[model samples]
Target: MADPMIALATGLSAVLLFLLMIGLTVYLLWKRRQDMRRDNQLISTNSVIPPCTPVLQTLQASSYGSAEVPFFLPPSFKSSTHSAMPEGREEEEQWKQHPHLHIQRGSLTIGSWFPLGSLRPDLYQLPEEPSEWAQPSGSTVRLCFAVQYQQEQEQLVVSLLQAANLPAQCQSSATLVKLQLLPSEDRHHRQAKAQSKGCQPQFNDTFVFQVSNNSVDQCTLRMSLYSVDRLKKHHLVGHVLLPLRQDELQEAAGKVLWRDLETDSDLPLSKHGNIQVSLNYNQSLQRLTVVVLRARGLQCPSNAGVSVQVSLQIHTQVVKTKCTPETRGSTPTFNEKLTFRLLPVQLDAACICLEVQQVGHEELAEVPSTRATAPVSLGLVVIGPFMYARGRELEHWNEMISKSQELVKQWHGLGAANNIYNNNQT
Candidate 1:
């Protein structure tokens, strides 16, 4: 009974002490949490802030429209203050504007864009057919021909045709017919005889060709009509081209197709003239020697002399020489030799052109007739780069190259001036 007061005071003192200690501990924890929250808010705010450097800002603005803030911020920072931040809200709006900036949940795609692989059809739906044909498959066909022509301007056309002076002519008789196969390495050709001069000449002929199924796509039958001359030089009159179509081949075993002939639009009518030349290359002397021997059938008017102007060309270099004029009504023999200094390698692109011209001389008062004026071109001949010429020109080139240092003489036909000059100029 005497210690009850003392015990009550002691219990009250212990309870007060325990309460104070708990209050202090709670206050300290609350302050620490507030500091941590402030620190986290600062970090989150700073993370969204753009850099101060102009270069960085320019790069960011160019690519992303603004500074890029990562979406995967710390969980504590995000749950507390992310939504409350103005920077964060602005970043969210930017990401919404450019949806490509967000991490999509499923398949990612550009706007309205699809992969090319998805456009391919299923392999099972493809058609079944051989892409290439088998080899050594072919057929044979026989073709027959008949020709008839009408003469216009009558005897004048015949005289022009006989002269071979004009570029165009109309004649029926003295025609020779030939058949040729196209795209064949052998250049298979056949011919029929000439008919007598008449208003209407008729020809009945036949030809056979070995055709292949694989080759029919590229094969063509060419029939040409020519006017034969006394010099054996055949002038092209007209021609016709027939492509071996599949329908034609199916019914062409013994077909006789009569088709009208048309003028050969591609053939260039050549004037009657010729130039003879000799070429010799001397390795020891480092020189190429060319001899202008003679010119025949030149178109020279009366009282005019014919002369030749020879030009040698290599790359862009040109060397010119001339021959003395010969009297009219005589076969002009130039016998003029022109020499060019060139190395063996330079001969690869070397060529020569001869121009036949008519020169006129007029005697003046007390002046000798040696003064010549007004030269007119009759025809031209070009013997060239050797590699590009065919037939006689190629044969002559081969002969000259095979027998170097020795002269090789050959006669080359001359055509219109435009033919050779235009080609070589380019």
Candidate 2:
């Protein structure tokens, strides 16, 4: 009996040990899994993606010409002479000026055909020459230039023909012509030196601006002349304004027209307020996000149910979004996020249009009225790449592109719509 009891006790002990071993194995696995999960969490917490560097080569101001091929000197010479070259900021100022002047590879240089100081069209008198031409006197300065809108190519060609009777400057001062399109003075085009005999300088340089047909009527050409001395000090000589609304612009295609320059104090100011927005682009996912944060100092009429609308134009695709529930004041807080599926290639041509509209309470109703009513646009602001955007608008876009998946916020000044809607969008 004692021997049998001992054997039973040993068997029970062995069974208990086996159960203990199984429990230990299960506990070890659970601990190991917990450790692995903690490690994974630590790894994920530390991972960060750095902003991407812009890979596009920096082209000179004149280099941004769409079809005009510049004579690029050797790399060593270009780098050494770049600082001394007057066109250092041409990429930023006149990037949009030349996108239509196509020069064949073997074609003669621009200077060969258009000689300096050659007798061209008379800007002051069209179709007929004045019996005796007299120089413009007093503070008035005249700019002689030619403008043509090519409907087929959608290009606005501006030729700096010549300037006669310019305001006298110090003999050491060299004249430069700064060209920029209004209502948005985002980019400026300049010609370093004009062949001058006294106050008359001849500039046969042609600048081509890419513009859509819809916004052509509202476009205005501003030519600002400046005198830069040997010390690089700049003085405003005068500026000429050519409003596209005039009938002469439509009639005088490639014909020279003379305009009187205005003083610096006469420059116009933006009456429209400002809008706050945020932009983000995810290259890997091919997505774009726009956030309409708020608006301030809006110049809208006092009306009920005032709301803001934001439009995204990607090539021919246009998507619009608006803030719900009308706001009363000129300053409206939207904080709305708009997302778009954009391809990598389409980013270069994408444009954003924001409009302040006064919507009637009746239009906001769910009844869906049959009567068609157009929302009155109070103020408008458009932002995009260098093609149609400048200043803060272009800077915001560039920041968004360089830092993918990162949000870039900016305050853009508002301006009159001026039918800027015709800028190639659906």
Candidate 1 lDDT trough over 10 residues, lowest sum: 153-162
In angstroms, what RMSD does candidate 2 have relative to the true structure?
37.0
The worst-scoring run of ten residues by lDDT in candidate 2 lies at 99-108
User: Residue 226 in model 2: shift from native, Å?
Assistant: 0.6
- The TM-score values for the models, in the order shown, are 0.32, 0.32
Candidate 2 off by > 4 Å: 1-139, 170-172, 184-192, 245-248, 266-426
Go through the candidates in order and give each one's C-alpha lDDT. Answer: 0.55, 0.64
- Name the top lDDT candidate: 2
Q: Which residue pairs come into collision in candidate 1? A: none
> Residue 55: error of model 1 in Å?
99
lDDT string for model 2 (37-78, tens) is: 988986776534323211123333353566644443211112
> How many clashes in each candidate?
0, 5
Error of 1 at 81 (Å): 99
